[model samples]
Target: MTQWQTRRDDGRAGECAGGRGAASLSGGPSAATDAVLPRLILDHARDGIALLDIRGRVLWMNPALERMLGWPLDLMRGRNPAEFINLPENRPGPAELAKFRYLPGSSLFQQFRVTRHMRRDGTRFWNQQSHALIDTGRQDAQKMVVVTCRDITDQVRVQTALERMKDDLEHAAYHDDLTGLGNRKKLSQYLGSAPVRASIGTGRVGVLQLDLDKFKQINDTLGHAAGDAVLRHIARALGATAQQGDLVCRTGGDEFLLICCDVGSKAALMSRAKAILRASRAPLAWKDQTITPGISIGASLCRGTPPTPETCGGEALIAQADQALYAAKEEGRGRAFFYTPELGARYRAERQLARDLATAIEQGQFIVHLQPILHLRSGRVTGCEALLRWQHPTRGLLAPPEFLGAAAQAQLLPQIDYLAMNASLDALVSLRDQGFDDLCLSLNVSSAILADADYPALLNWAMQSRGLPPGCISIEILETSFMNRGAPDGCDAIARLRRLGARVALDDFGTGHAGLAHLSTVELDAIKLDRSMVGRLETDGRTRVIARAIIRLCRMLGMEVVAEGVETQAQIDILGRARCPLVQGYGVARPMPLAELPQWLLENKAFSLPVTLPPRDEPSPAAPPAGRARRRGDNSI
Candidate 1:
């Protein structure tokens, strides 16, 4: 009934304090001043203001309040506040209200909340509302509640958008974008969290580290897009194969980590590894190719008695898995292996050896030893194979088998290979200076070095600088070198060397699967029979027949046959009977340091054979010139 509670047709409140009920709102002796000041402040204020009874029935509203709700004062008066604003049903009780009472000698108490309010058009906006109890001073009337509202829709929207952006950034940081799998950071966080540690204390946790076997070959043979597709397919397969509680993560290129929290025993962990290995074998259809992926898995289990940091730490567990992975790859890829104490010990030793290798290269500790290759019929030293050795300060002289694996893993193969090549070429230069120009120095090279575009140039430079002829240098490559799909064709690399006038030989011929096939496709000067076949020559009659057949085959193919690891005269007789031209083994002579080679050749110059063989119809391939050979009484050095 108050004039201030009424609204005009323009949707605004009427004049303030124009009715008896409105005047009564000013309770003291300065009622007139109070009424005028309050009206001026409420009418000019930007925020919406409303007055309600104790029952939350709207009694009055300001012009701003009328505009904010889109409802006129006349329509809003005497109606519940909920009809216009979406207030929560549960209001503060008397005890809760007591905590909000602040000012002394006043009935004013405040409560603040954020809620949604609706307009006449049924649109909703975010509203920040403040409610306060006010003393009315009329004995018959209950205390009034003063409410103020602010439209915060824009602020709320900004805050909501910011929250969503933060969530998206967090998701991106923890996930691999290529596969949408958790990354190493996420895995680290999970493994290092307190809950995970506590769980490990109560039970066992298994970690599986997976590496794609020959993944580089895939990238080399196919394009990078194919490699990416394979990775995504593997990720999907892992996600589907993983148990509910397990976490699958892409640690880095072609490497994945899986954390299983429910591993009860070693058997359970092994079973999970087996399942992953099987899952990885499923072929992926990529473009026009059906790519069969292979993975090697290494598993480790961590069990803590009381959850010590050392026992359940992420690094230690991952290291164990990595060592097992190395072992799995060593044994041959596409399989799974569990971590053992021995593996850890070997891993530690290898790591230490890797560190020592860096020091060895720096200190000039690596040296070359020459093993003489003899002509079986003449019993004459013809050429020598350059073998790498490490003169460790504490471990004496270490052979290639003792440290080459560690060196390869440490990525020091290039440096070691270069060292061997330079040393061998220098020795060849020294031999030619001493009138042994026909003696060939065979230097072993890895596939990685052979595939390098710059390798031939490096070799040419080294030989030119040493004043050595390329014909006196023989580059020996392993059969496995030809099997690397990631590198250029072995025949191409060999041809490149041969174009430089250097002969190439396939070392360890009978040990590999494709040696016979390679002899046909690969243009080569010679083939070396593996030591395994040479070791079985006297005992295994089949080995002798195979050796004889290989020698005759190589002779017909315009190739030379060098029997390796020959240790006895009986073996030499068999090879001579087979017309094998070359023999090199411990029985002929042990590998001696470069400095000792001259004296050893001098002493062995008089060495004669016990048996003689029929002369060959054709000259042997890759044999040195007749002028390069020394007579029985000739002083070569």
Candidate 2:
């Protein structure tokens, strides 16, 4: 055996003496050994290689280490690795690792950790290191640790970019774009997660639903930008007023939802509701205008009661809160309501009705019924008001009040309005073909249609396509639509209809916020007295007085005054005495289908010679009939 000493390429002797290591080099147990080959391999290795004493002081470094760290081997040698290596904050440094107890003579290999190393220029690079202890096999030899490092900066950058992308996606998924609040996705996620339910397992949690009353008015009148500003302010107010651990979300247009965990009692929840109300009610300065949006809130609670099918999860709670919210709106806005079993039952019933309504529209179950409007003086059916009736597959005829709210809420009112308009137009053409050519059909238009600028053009096109004159169709809108200050476009729609030779009437007058002042500004062919005024005329002297005033004002404005809901002879007599020009109700004739109108006219002897109207002071394109009629009973149906 020939013992050989290990030496560097620089002719410096190394600590290790090779016996079989020298023999293994030549593939035989002989003295032919090449110690320079091992040093050359380490010096030229692609990976940065460093040899360190047990105390972690660098003994030698490869050329690759010098290039990777921007430090030459001469500058790196004899320096502690900790001086140049940077670990993340709170991680142990090389000195700490060296002090860590290890089994004596243990030779762990391929130990890996990613660390940041500072270059001589103070720039940092990420390095993935594999460290191991190499035994020198000499009696006075100190153990040398070999650390092999590869630059992993590009890999780390890719992983960091991926992480940032994931975070951005999470933020977009959870936040509402307009309000910057948590969105429906966040709400659903939080409710399904364990953290929210962990605090109150089958116990008390509260959900409060908030809606901005008449929020559409802001959007319609001031522009959507103002509405968006209002919504953002409302969201901020809700967030600020909410206590810790409360989840607030903007669930829909003009709607918000809050989930409160560990709610102690109804009173505690009420306090939160009040805070939100106050915050929202605080005047918001927008576009140089003070906008105080009214907020309606409804709350539902899941108490310690065991979870049932009805109270299973957050969705059920949300449904209950929605019911309460409807009640709050009904009870007048700017208040809060708590969920009750009765409200829940009613909500379910209404939901079912809404579902049925969608089907009814699709299946053409909705039929148009025309109630004859009689000229008060001549006792003649001049025109008919088109009333909506749902001819259910099982429930028989249903009135508008039964399903209109549901339709409005489900955003199906526009469809219903379209159907009704078509039915009315068809009926009008049918009536004209049946020797009722001169008759005018009064059809109710919804706010949704009036909001659309294109609706006027569509209506004109429909009438033109039918070869029917626009004068044959009269558009009627609720007084609330007229009273809407935000939607001047609705009035514009009315003007557009008038320009197309269609008569416009304000329906259900005296029920909404419009007053005599509104009559001065709102242009119309007629103003129909609301049923409330008509129904109470004989009983309530105040109603009689109001009706008389309304009729007088309308007449002076050259607008026809139609009295609605005149069910009794006395109501009719009183309206006649009040000089109301037109009246429509069960008293005149119940709302009959389009097919029954001619028969009803024949049976009730409702047709006199066609009455001619006097010229109005306002010079309307389609004025109401006030002219004297010639004696021609030959025009009978």
Candidate 3:
């Protein structure tokens, strides 16, 4: 029979080269036939193969074994196989496999798990040592074992993948997908089913709801991509700001709910809040855009009750946090506020105040405060704008912030509008009969009135009945009213009023982002710069520079300029330098009723001012020739 010895091509590992064994076997088999079988098996083997003697000497090997182990088969003769062949620790090596009990007369297959095995150059492969014992009755009638190996590296990789999927599935079940924080379901499970603590404990649960301010504006104006970027940035910041016991989650879009378990001290919670605020203010570097995101946070502490601190309702905590968030926004953005009993009281008070407003309006608790509008060119009291003030009996006199929202809710806007409109029109008609020529009255009109089909007819009837000049009455409109230009019959109402001889002036201009854009679209006779812009104009000389630029722009567009909310003489001085055509605010006169109109006229003796025209004043171009301008400026009774 023939035996084989195997070694690597590099002369270090085993290569099985088939060789004839001269020994004769006792099994009734021919010696030549047995030798042919060993040679045939070694040459046809797929893996590198080898044969070893009892003394661990490599006698024969195949060509595949030499290439597989990087060793030459010839060089491996008479060497200890254990010294050169590597074995894995967890499995049997060649020496261990040789100890397998076997009958020398019979052929048997034995597999030795490779504890560790190495290449000729010392690299490793997972190997399985497969062998069989056979008896050859030659050379003292000895028995031999033949061995082969196959690599299993790719199988190990597949096994690792299956393990990872199992781990990921387990994680996804209890954590939020967006932020990897504990989800609401997990929170409910923990608070509901978790074990208890001692009767006396420091277990407080602080839940905070954080909302991103101006996030919707980014979504609407810059596309949802920007909005998503902002959300992800917020998630990262809040996650890092949280404590070991705190969990932060994205409750929904642009809203993060943080849960701090066992937070007992107010000082500790405040410290945590300061950390969150600092992190939220960090700049978000996304897609080359650095966005400084602002967060409004509302925090509420759950009351503790006995063993395990009886858990508070999650919905109640969320609601309290939401109210706190709203208050934070009202106070200004980028802040964390705790929900307190005082805040709860304020909430109840404001809610009740909002409800009582409609009744107040219907009861005629709303009065008109007439602020005098002065002619800039001649410095004469040309008109007055009827500003609405609400006199709530219990709440005292409330301004626009008080009743404006309620008027909209009760659908009493038209009623409120008519009240102010008629009162000013009646007073003007009375003043005209008292020989005040060319006197004008300006009343604020909502887009609601323009939407009314009878608005043009309504104003015409009132003007004709009073024998008043149609051109002497003007309506003030906000610049933002045209934002919804897509409305049906867009601006048709404003156009009809123009056709009815009522002039229109744009009010609160320069306060909106699209203020300049609205100017060319609407046919405005004058632009009233808003208080913020006027107040801004004082601090920022650049603001007046912009104001001058706007004045230049209005002049190019053939529109007049009116400066609103001019309280101080300095504001008037600035307006004078800008050559504003009109000014209205306390710097001129306070709003009074019809009975006081003649008294104001007598005190100013406005009629004589244009005759002694100040060096800086220019008589209005609207003033007729010389005599009319003189009489209108004549302030004496």
Candidate 4:
């Protein structure tokens, strides 16, 4: 394309510098062919070729030239090319090309375009016409000018088609298939595009990540087919309410996202969000079933040079929104809340607790509390379960529920195991020194640590190095953790732990879909029924039935069952009579402080075990029953 463009001294468009005369340009060679040789020279060129005489007349033009210009030779000849074909005679450029003036006395060529060139029939096509002057290799030869015209209409049409397709493909790449809205991938890409304050003066762009509350439960109860329908309907509702040019995406299951742009104010943005919520709350009908979906929305401003989605990044906007959403659920459902500076400060405090918890074991901030698990039949203190607690000095006895929450949020399950291991070891040493032999102390274990390949070595080193009997130290892994049915090496971790002489307690049984299967391979020494199961047992027969089944299942496996959260004496009498051997509960004692537990042991030293069994020998009426009617006169069984 780097042609030798000849420019006039005055900066006008000119033809190529190395222009050849007709004889040299083509040599079909006949003396008779010589006079019309320039015509022949122009005839076969691919680009439209036209020759215009100095009088502004089209003296001759080629077949390709006529086709390009949409003109015939009969109509074109003897008329000025300009009269037939129109152009912007006064284009802004160098004086000579603008005026169509030739350079003085030289073999000059010019390439100038006609803005609107017309055909012989008055139809127009765009042309990029080039003009050149030639010498006949004779002294008095008239300067013959050659004009070449090329049509660019089809090229323009194809280019237009390609541009449209490019836009469409780009849209397809980033949009959700069903919603015709931005997908997560496109949202991420758009987040990457540097957000700048438009001089057009729209307010800042903010993102709201709204996940439907209890969505999974709904999906499970109703069916994912209905779940998918609800999701689509909600998406449609929210999409209809979204601002023009605003983006909406279904990030994942039942989580729809909004990228709000050009709002007038925060209040206006809030209104938009409220609209979405209202739209979602409207009942959706699918396959003759009507259901209402509730949305929990977290909105945050993208406040930087290139604002990324706070919703998508770690501890970023999503966490803020999520915490706020959860807080809304805590206060009540069917509500919306904004994350404020106070919430952030509270989150910072919680996160600090989570982070400090990393070194909790290393710094000896965590300690174990041993609450005695009494045998229902034996009427003796059989064992104690090691409940992990953070004895945060300044904070003062932070319960497992407090820091454990943040630990789960931070996804620090391994940290819990690490701390719990040391805490368990220390408790074993303490229990041994206290002459509490033949007593089993259980420590809670997370599924994450159990899934670790090196968990056995870690547990062994902690237990064996401390001269702790693996039999005396039971590790309580949650029942739900072992329920990954098709997991690679499923339950293999627990099997390894059992081989290491550590008894695994299936903590929180009856909490998941897989109940029996969890106990099958878990090799549990015990099962602790969750408090939810226990709390409703007196009222809900179904709960009592499940507890009875769980107790029977544990007994069948030769495993002891510990019913947790035993608050009422009735609960105790229920389990005691059912002969569910061992139980730990608030009715017996709340998780006492490690310091207070030893004292609790001493205070309850003359422990008339609150257990039931048929006497080995018949008790004479004369001899007082061990638990006196006054031990009953205190009237708290």
Each prediction's Cα lDDT score? 0.80, 0.77, 0.68, 0.66
Clashing pairs in 1: none
Cand. 1 Cα-lDDT: 0.80
Residue 388 local lDDT, model 4 = 80
Please name the candidate that would achieve the greatest lDDT relative to the true structure: 1
**lDDT, model 1, position 17:** 48
lDDT per residue for candidate 4 within 1-637, as digits (tens), equals: 1123334445554443212222232211332233344444555567876666554456678777777666788987866565556655532334433355345353435347645566666666667767777556654324456776777777766877999999889888888766576777887775555552341123366567777877876787799888887788888888788877676887776677777766544576677778888998999876767889988776655444444444233226546666666566656666677766678788788878877887775687777777777555544555677788787867888778788768877788687768777876787687667865555677777767777789888888887788876666677776556654233455677678788877777778777656777666555566778888889889988878778777766656667677888888788777765557667777777776566766676576444655464343422112123333211011011
Better of 1 and 4 by TM-score: 1
Error at 59, model 4, angstroms: 4.5
What TM-score number comes out for model 1?
A: 0.86
Predicted candidate 1 versus true structure: per-residue lDDT over 541-591, tens digit per residue: 998888888988888887777888989989888888888888899889999
TM-score of each model, paired residue for residue? 0.86, 0.77, 0.50, 0.60
Clashes of each: 0, 4, 53, 7
Q: What TM-score does candidate 4 reach?
A: 0.60
Q: After superposition, how far is residue 147 of candidate 4 from its true place, in Å?
A: 5.7
* C-alpha lDDT (0 to 100) for residue 372 of candidate 3: 74
Winning model by TM-score:
1
Q: lDDT rank, highest first?
A: 1, 2, 3, 4
